[model samples]
Target: MSPFPFLSLLNWAKTQGRHSLPWRAYFHLSIKDLGYHIWLSEILLQQTQVERVIGYYDHILEHFPTIESLANASYEEFFPYYQGLGYYSRARNMLETAKIVTEEYGGIFPNNADELIKLPGVGPYTAAAIRAFVYDEPLLSFDTNLEKIFSRYYHGNRFRKLTQKEKTLLEKDFRDTGISGREMNAAFMDFGSMVSLNIKPSDDNKWKKNTKDYPLSDCLWLKTHGTLEIREKKKKTVFPTKDASIIVVLHENHRIYYSSTEGEYQSFLLPPTENDIRHAIQDFFRSKFNLELSVRPIHDKYFENDRPFVVCNAQVQKGDTLFAKYRKENGFFVENT
Candidate 1:
């Protein structure tokens, strides 16, 4: 009944939606079940590929099993279960949130935006997702995929956040269609994943050939726009690059000194002045391990995050008091004999 073609979208979803996904079974689940299953999956699926999350999802469920179980464990206890999933901070946040949900809220995830967003690692988009999926709230979870779909299909290829008035009107229109918010959101997810791919026009030659049979292709606003100039121009964000440095200290004992500080051993910010690099490294070693180091800059490496790191090799100049101190602190030798 909505002007936004919900019937067509629902029909498309029935045929093309990822119906068999494990987390899609939230229809009759209680809040606890939804929290355990859907919330965990959504968190894992953040910036992670669906394929990559599937095994971890099952593994997490096998270990935690419930919100209460997850809550009972500290981050240290939960680390092994969540190890391979690179973002240790997310795991920590998940543990903190689980504990809050279990101990404070009696294991019931908050259904409203205000309460939901207050949870650790739960932002506005995540809160929207939980509200729509768990509480059947009439709202859209505007992630990159949905943003692409809505921008092309409705906003004339202009990608921008919808105004509050716009969202309310759209929600009202969507509610009139009698489709539950969960199903509608799922359809958008499928349509975005299947049809509104992020392929650029120049790069779409192969995609065009592959997706020629897709029914959703007919509804793509890009088809009506014709020229690439009219399509949404992706905005690229330029991040200011910073230089960092790390020193790998090797001892004659064949053991390497390591520190968990900065989440990497011997990592520190590269000083702006070339002369300061050695002194900075020395200061860090003195302060952290109470050891003086003979430092030599090795080679620079750039990480995926676009930050450059100057790798350095260091030899222990002094630290006779080190063996006693290092044993009590986080910094340790990798293979201490």
Candidate 2:
């Protein structure tokens, strides 16, 4: 095993870890509610920032209030709360898991990893998190942060998964250090996120130079090895931009309209099109919102992909009940332009 100071890591976590996160706040609640909250928080946190998740987590807890409430809500009812949080699948999976838990487990969350993994969206990392945080079980939750820590400390670089041997060494280190699993996992996450960040080469070196006050200063690859070799950065992909259009739908009283589409990044704007701008806007409104809109070009510009796009503004037809109903049902909210 690498001669890293695992005990130092645990000591750092005791004073510096993010112990006040939303999920951790729920630990003092009822056991049934504790599992549900932790599960929801873990799923929401995947590939998302903690700052962004705080509001969403609070809103979801306020609306759903319990696992049964979330399970009983329809997709339409639930999708609103999850709007703008990319990864729609996570929300859908959470609904499915809630239903399963309510029906199969009598509303009590399963304590073991095997049973927890059967729930939708509960991957290995999330399952371990639930066991560790909610049940206080001694299990490792290997997230991206921990992955970076282990990969760099063990291999002196990243872009790889931990080998079985590395996993064993880590487990043994944790055990021998007398650190509980939850504390160890939390320490790795905090240390990796706050202290051992993988930045651009210049910033990485600067961060290394200031490591005297950082947690587990000697264990960092840059400190131990005096240098770090990063994997080659991936080349940026260039997409040939065809003609595209962004529709700005405006309702009465200065209300601006927006909708979300599924993709790698959740887009508030409609699809990019190569057809005639007017026809494309008409078709998009008809197909997606089932309403025909007359749009006028506001601006024409080229975006990052080097494609020409027209930003068109349209007004909601007077007394259009269908448009109003669609807006309400789809949870469309207005933003001031």
Candidate 3:
């Protein structure tokens, strides 16, 4: 609709994009190393902010620098570095994928979309990202950031998913520009993140003050409609309230053991219920951590994630070596003396 706006966005991204991010440097890395780094970054960035992911990404690479190291380590071995990152399943999928790559493909990632998609936890978006970033294939990563940029640029702030016909037309426009896939996709992603922001800047913001024309001035949407349109806010999904019981088991040594929820933020959870809350909590510990504890509810308080839960504390009533060993070794057991 607006001739893709490729050149303008690319030029903007060049001076202002996120260049310091560790994963963006592909020049010094071999193809195998490049794939591993990009894959890890993409998975960690899923539903997570860039600021939050940087530390974890570095910590993970520090421990497991190669695919072989990651594949050789157990989830428990990797969990400490990955803990508090939330989305435990992403780590699990990453571990599975690492093993697959190590054992099946000799520690090298597949270059094509078809083969890359077959790996664990890899979907179209991730596959596309790997191809574009690592292999420099001429493909769009097509995540929400780019979606927002395109929606506003094409539809004038009527933020909606682009249709296939629109994407095809844009791709054709992109190809006509003869930009490299690496440069174009990187520019689009950075523009969406840094420039095409969700919150509109204040009128006197430096960006507007410095330039005679506001950003995207040449785009058809902005040219035809002088100002951004305000779309009615979509209602947030209301999850059904669920009651949960959380146990904090403390050892005489001042260390505590806790159970973590999977998939969602290590945050609030709507965990499935069993016959009763006590049994559910007990069953979870027994099945998952191999620890049997006599849980007695001490108080009712909302846990860190803001879910209403029964806070129960268990003394070292039983000894589970698996927990004890890891707690000591990985500092899983935490509390000051």
Q: Which structure among the candidates has the greatest TM-score? A: 2
lDDT string, candidate 2, 179-241, tens digits: 566666677777776778555555656665666577655454655452565555899865333
lDDT of 1: 0.68
State every prediction's TM-score relative to the real structure.
0.66, 0.69, 0.68
Question: Which portions of model 2 miss their true places by more than 4 Å?
Answer: 200-205, 208-210, 224-226, 232-237, 242-288, 291-337
Give lDDT per model, in order.
0.68, 0.69, 0.69
lDDT of 3 by residue, 142-243 (tens): 877777767777776635678988988887887777877888888877766665543343444643444344356654344434246555589986532244
Give lDDT tens digits, candidate 1, residues 1-337.
1256666788878887899888898767788789668789889988888888988998888988889999899765787777666544577789989999888889988888899899998988888888888888878787777766655555545354556676676667877777878888989887777766544455568556645654544444557442332545699764322345443544332244544352334433444334566667777778987876656545444554655555655555456533311121354434333
Give one clash count per candidate, in the order shown: 0, 0, 0
Worst 10 residues of 1 by lDDT: 321-330
Error of 1 at 43 (Å): 1.2
Q: Which residue pairs clash in candidate 1?
A: none
